[model samples]
Target: MTSDSRTLQIPEHQQDGAAQKSCYQKLSDEHVEELELYRKNGLHPVHLGDVLNNRYEVLHKLGHGTSATVWLCFDTQTSAWKAIKIIGASHSSDDRPELKFQLQLSRSDLVALPTDHFWLVGPNGRHVCLVMPPLGPSVSSKHQTMDLEALREVSMQAADGLAYMHRKGICHGDFRTGNLLFRLDSARINDLSKGDMLALIGEVTKIVVETDFGEEPGSISPRYLVHSLNTDIFADFITCQIAVIGLSLAFEITKPPKTSSVDLPYASPQLLLRLPPSTHSDVWALGCTLLEMQTGSVFGTAPFEIMQSMELLLGPLPKPLQRTWSRVYPEEMLHPEGNTEYLTWRSDVISEIKKHTRNADCLLKELAMSRKQSLKGLLAADDKNKPGSIVWQVPEKQVTQIGDLIKQTLSYDLHTRHTADAVVQHVWFDQARIHRKPRV
Candidate 1:
């Protein structure tokens, strides 16, 4: 489908007028998918009690993406829990590349694949429903609480999964920590009753969808929108294995898609330069993911900001792309003299320290003031205003090794960049393998 068709547009009759204003209702809650998208070729409306394929019974909403809504369902035939991803009518097709790639890798242990797929004839059109084994929350959502050792394991496993895919001539166009999910123990979850499952994952939260007018949603929209559940309650049951998912953008190395979407922060320099997606680009993305795991934050959020940060840290763009970069971004927007955001963050930290030291002895207050001055001096350094230039709190030795690996993978020249297989064999991962501990 063309991009224009997927754009949300309210009917012309409901554009302006008392009747038009009465046609729509605003939802106050946050994190819910846009209601305007629940029309025509957008989302396929699935209710809480709806039984799909006469086997999978909908239990609760897991989450929703731009083109699909995922649900937790009970499999009557298999007597197990499964996740069903219902793709929107516009994106769903029997010959879609995502489905084809999924079926090709169904037997691989490195990725999560649909066990079965069927079509649902909705009011809009046919929606492709994929049944999969339920997994835990993404690694990015839970990485903050994990210790260094746990982070190492996740990094190693993720790199290995990427290497496995690259070897099969596949490129995961959108490779990032958010696409890596922790594996859940299916044996334990399968034995739980519906009531027990609810107790474990918490009750489902929903709010009714009401229009200003009295028009019924019927098949066009869901009766109520379900809030996505947090899977932190199952943290203890998360296994060491991590599954690489979100294959909608994945494609064969021989044939790159005409267009693709990727998270800005994790997007490789090649992708940002409008170069074709390749296995090398995947390696660059993996580098960004590894750095995020170690730092607990992304390097930068905006495209220009990320580009500036990359230049500051990884040196200038390759000679071949320097002219392209200059053309794409104006010189005025390239780099600013100082970062107000960074200064504000430092100021807040200093204020907190002073507030805590107010009740301390004179020597303690003096020490706090000395520390504040030291921070100020650090900020005065040449690279202080650069994004992601803060000093890492990890041990010096560990930081050096991790930084070396990341630099190798994030090389400006794709020819010089490390491949996924080479990344898995890096010295840092070798050390990680030697010191890896079992997750409790």
Candidate 2:
């Protein structure tokens, strides 16, 4: 269960206590000391400029999250760069359906996995490390900027990856921007020379610093250089990865939807309320993410904010979810303006909601009320859809296409949501348009 307990092929004479202590020192970075107190399937600590088995040399600490510390490592043996994710024991049982799914396909059919895992003996103990091809910053990183064209490309590629996985019966449990990284070539950076775009990718690709902090013995943080990457490339790639993360979850392509925990803001209503996660749920999350990219803010400021936002803009939940919501916060159901579907108590719409959710039909009687809207009132001051508002700033043609595409994916009615394959075929992305070609 602990990496330290795992066997290492080091010779006994060389693996003395003092040597082991020294090795541990060499393997540490900013968070390594805290990470050294390893948890099961959790994060293992890492230091900057460390070397593993004299093969993979840690160049710089890239990033760290709850699960692992990622490093930009230089592979001495292959004379190339790679990403090394040093992880602990907690996720030992995390089912990576993609691995099995990939085996069934030819190399050409598969996109990259987050990382290809392996084990390495370190100063503290043995660690499970994932070795991946080197890449640049996260698309969600603060520096990223996206235009309409870039977003479309991102959506298309993401759909492609998800469609491949969905067809093989897998769901990406966690689909978010941080997990998606990109590598932009010199040619792409050149595209940025057009405007302030150059600033988004930063000044250069490589930088040699003593450490993320300052100078020390193991202080050499070797970052590589290629060309300054463009922000658009990062955005496009991230959108693609978001799709991949959704497909990575557990679900049979041909079966009913399943359920799992997800981030609060991006979580589908069903996921938030403990309902089964289906292809539709992923669509909902995608809608929220895309919206965030467009507006630079989440739909809600808090739990109540989300509920209020959904009721106002997206509509007052599918009948089943509404029924569940009404029970917990019965007060929320009493809308003075009659915001339950444009003041029309359409039995047919209720029937459809019921038909889609066979279980919900049994939970509540037909929802009958004059449809009124709370969202129009809340956002009345600056309706995002209006002409004078920021949303309207997007080119007219693009606004309709992008909004329609995202809305279709965010359809509150699960049945109305777009599937990954359907998303790929969307006219918004399929429509003909001029594209900038990179020489590289």
**Best-fitting candidate, measured by lDDT?**
1
Candidate 1 residue spans exceeding 4 A from truth = 1-30, 330-393, 434-440
Q: Candidate 2: which stretches are off by over 4 Å?
A: 1-41, 93-98, 104-111, 121-126, 142-144, 185-259, 328-392, 432-440
Kindly state the number of residue pairs that clash in model 2. 24
Tens digits of lDDT, candidate 2, 242-286? 223222345564654555766767777677666776666766766
User: Quick one: RMSD of model 1?
Assistant: 10.6
Report the Cα lDDT for candidate 2: 0.48
Q: How much lDDT does each candidate structure score?
A: 0.72, 0.48
Q: Residues 191-276, candidate 1, lDDT per residue (tens digit)?
A: 88878876776656666654445444455766667777677677777787889999888889999876558888987877776767
Q: How does residue 176 of candidate 1 score in lDDT?
A: 95
Best by TM-score: 1
